[model samples]
Target: MGGATTEPADEKPAVYYANCAEAKRAGAAPLHRGEPGYRKALDRDGDGVACET
Candidate 1:
């Protein structure tokens, strides 16, 4: 008798793309300036906090 075969799981689930650029070009809020992965896209002066609000 042949047993049931299992397929590899998709490690990268759908949620992985939830916040990806492809998901929303607008992009999500940052984890506070000067933090990790803090792209200076908004902070022109690179001083963190775009306008010092």
Candidate 2:
């Protein structure tokens, strides 16, 4: 049987930016609703858009 695969130590964790500007500065802007690192906090209005500056 095959065992579960482990994540690489060098792999970085998902980053949740405080605002769209922050996410854009990190080159992770234009985030959609389901994209990684996208959080509801980023979408203050909760209109299915995140990190939209």
Best-fitting candidate, measured by lDDT? 2
Write down the RMSD of candidate 1 (Cα, Å).
8.7
Task: Look at candidate 1 and give me any clashing residue pairs.
Answer: none
Candidate 2 lDDT (Cα, 0 to 1): 0.82
Tens digit of lDDT per residue, candidate 1, span 1-53? 68987656865422222332432343433324654334556445766643232
Backbone clash numbers for all candidates listed: 0, 0
Q: Please identify model 1 stretches exceeding 4 Å from their true place.
A: 1-38
Q: Which residue pairs of candidate 2 clash?
A: none
Per-residue C-alpha lDDT of model 2 across residues 1-53, encoded as one tens digit per residue: 68988889999887678778888998888787888878888887888778676
